[model samples]
Target: MTIIDYFTQLGSNPYFGAGFGLFGVGAAAALARKGMQVGMILFRRHYMMTLEVPCRDKSYQWLLQWITQHARHTQHLSVETSFQQHETGRVKTSFDFIPSVGVHFFTYRGTWIRVERNREQHTLDLHMGVPWETVTLTALGRDKGIYFSLLEEARSLALEREEGKTVMYTAVGSEWRQFGHPRQRRPLGSVILDDGLGQRILADVRDFIANPKWYTDRGIPYRRGYLLHGPPGCGKSSFITALAGELQYSICVLNLSERGLSDDRLNHLMSLVPQQSIVLLEDIDAAFLSREDTAGVKAAYEGLSRVTFSGLLNMLDGVASAEARILFMTTNYLERQVLALPLSWASDPFEHCSYYVCLCDNFI
Candidate 1:
């Protein structure tokens, strides 16, 4: 039989023809998919503008907060709830919804924006102990200025949300992370310090911050340290928190007794403290007894903390220490054995008197 006649006979068979039809359909579908992918690549390259915010970036939270407040078309959602208890025995509950791991769409200034929230299951943020995530904002047009405007707006909203609030931060690994939602600012009057002591300390801090130029001209380190020593429950910590609120400054709480905290890490952390923040070291006596006893107590305290007395001293006044910084060290005991080292380091030591009194009409 001729070749044409053999092909004609095979076409007449139902199973062969069916198989051949299915093969052609598969090939066509694959070609279409490839073409579509190429088209999308071209579109994204030429027409789309994108801004990617990683989970580690400060802008990540701003963008997420903006999306939660402004994005109207988000379908997939993640909820964050916070509870606060008032002194009057009332509890306040709040719920916030953000875009989940998916694509969402919203409009801004007559422009359609696409947000893609992605989480990498296999990757983890070592510092935060959470999965890695990224939020990509894509717009149809290639105007970079629009993206900048969007980001600025998001930042403004975040600032407004945190207005009149005191943000608390803590050391995570070698970096500082926000501890929780910003707390309402406590009035300095609420803290009852003896004989205008709160006002005196507040004025001193304000003067130090305001006279940076004087410090620079005088070749001073532009740093200050305050020691608040008193018995427990004397409001040493409460006064510091109130002082931070008065100055509109964040608090970076540092724990010197944390395990695995090395001298190098301490130096690094001190050098890179967040702007307009007070570095607070609570219970300074518990961290280290005395500089002279470090060698004798090394074996017993080695497992609790790796930081040495010399290292602590270096971090306090070393070349690597941050400039224009304020340090607050609190302790219950100001005895020679407990605070011998810190007393020498503290520029101004304020002794807290044990008393209970409210200065403000309404105390928090």
Candidate 2:
């Protein structure tokens, strides 16, 4: 039968006609849907601008803080609550609401922006031990300058919040993560050291920081090392913390005795330390008793620490060591033979002797 005759016969059958009509309708509907998708894609590609902020980026924190401040514009929200205890024994609680995992809209400088927060459940951020998250901001038109301005504003806000505070960081899997909320800056005067000792150390640090060029012009490594040795209760750690606050620098505390911390990982972590931060190695003498101890006897402290003494030496002044770095090592035992090697290896070693003396009235 001819095609036209077959269609004519099929049309005569009610069921066949209905089936054919449904097929035609479905094909048309599918074509319309495809056309709409293509149109939307073209429109977005040609007329829209998007910025993606990943959770790993510092800007992500800034953007989130900004969003939290402007939470009133969001319909869906996520809350982060924190409690702070004052010296007066009063506890204060704060709740911060931010845009949740969904599409949100807000107005920025007379422009409508769409924010889409998405979390990938299948993916995990090993460093944070959480699901991967991304915040995408979409705006109409092609101008990117507005986005830059917005980011700058967010950064300014974040910095203002962090002003006059000390940030502490710790290594997590070769990455430096902020340990806790930024603490109030401790006044350098509050810490008491031996007569004139504190001032001398502070002056030396200021001088070194001020004269970065002197080191560079002479082909010297732009770094400084300090060894604070004293008895257990001599405030060695407290002094380091106070010094960091006085210098307006952050602190990166690394534990050399951390299990699974291999030489390569230690090197990597040291090299990637945050800028304007002090690298603190507390209890340096405890990491290893002696160079020979770690070098000769592997089974003695098996699975304790993968870092070897030679690896530590290499990380200290090795070719991969970070420039413009300040390293501080504190130990209770100054006479430990293990310290001899590292002390000699330091480029600019300042050994501070801390001792306590009691003075009382003769009348007593």
Candidate 3:
């Protein structure tokens, strides 16, 4: 072939076309994710609080002002203290509202804690229920997490919890530890994957993102697992691309051989993932093996006690993760290690080759 002809033909080469196509897919995926960001703000929860703060009077005016001022500006906190039954002896009050995020107690253990409602039992024990939710609108500032500080200030005004006195603040469910991600998910690009199985995989991924309640509505954690298995040509890697695109989640690709990661490193990597994205663990079966086990020898699996298990649990069942993200695992084995399993990871998907795609080179 003449150099000129060879160069011209090379420009049209399938490999080159595929490479360019992959690039296009990558760009399209990035843009699609950008479009999805607008939806993140919708995830932000509306926080509400109802407690008996001293009325807007001089005695309790300082606390009331602090709470009202802070609540008016806080991103994940809100408050409403009504003038309930008043007594010349002391103040006692109640309220009704839901907080979707978490509660921050200033007295001690200032960390944010999710408010899980046990409807059957506590229906009469508490004053009000706070509903916490997820939201992505740029939460204003560090100082913006004002509810906790406000409580601290308000508590200072009250003497102590006594029969004659009233409670200044009673936290509802859903508290905010911080306005951010828990595990930083490293940016691992989309995987090479199979077509037919890839199609099914992408569909599940889309379902995961668009209607996460479909999983959570069943009372299960909002995480879904997938197992990708096939002979070399079936496109397990490329399928990840379509899946990432379909889900609008970031891809954090992990190598199983780099399995020696410390729990903190893995947590650090996972904490970077934003609200809606995928944390991809590829060749996960091989990753479970310990280094002492040489080639062809496998490591005897331990339960979730290992650092690996801790990391997996942190990523998979970590209370820190937002409800909307997806965690995906790819493996050649349709494997299930029931003996070492935890109830939290029951939704793991198995890799099966029953699904097939007809490619350009094969006509069936």
What is the C-alpha local distance difference test score of each model?
A: 0.80, 0.79, 0.44
lDDT per residue (tens digit) for residues 149-266 in model 1: 8889999998898899999999898789888888888888987878888887788789888988887887767887776777887888898899999999999998888887889999
Per-residue lDDT of model 2, residues 1-364, tens digit only: 9999997988899999888899999999999999999999999999999999999888998898897776466878888888767768898898988888999888888899999899999999987889999999999999999899999999999889779988999998868988877877877887788776777778877887898888888877777776778888787778778889999999999987788788999999988999999999877666775443556444644456778777877777777778888887777765553335633443332335583111111100
lDDT of 2 at 197: 76
lDDT of 3 by residue, 120-218 (tens): 333342323322222111222334445455556656643232222211111111111121112222122444333455556566556555775566567
TM-score of each: 0.84, 0.87, 0.36
Best of the two (1, 2) by lDDT? 1
Itemize residue pairs with steric clashes in candidate 2. none
Better of 1 and 3 by lDDT: 1
Query: Which candidate leads the pack in lDDT?
Result: 1
Ranking by TM-score: 2, 1, 3
lDDT for 15 (candidate 1): 99
lDDT of 3: 0.44
Backbone clashes, candidate 3 = 47
Using TM-score as the yardstick, the better of models 1 and 3 is: 1
| Total residue pair clashes for candidate 1 | 0
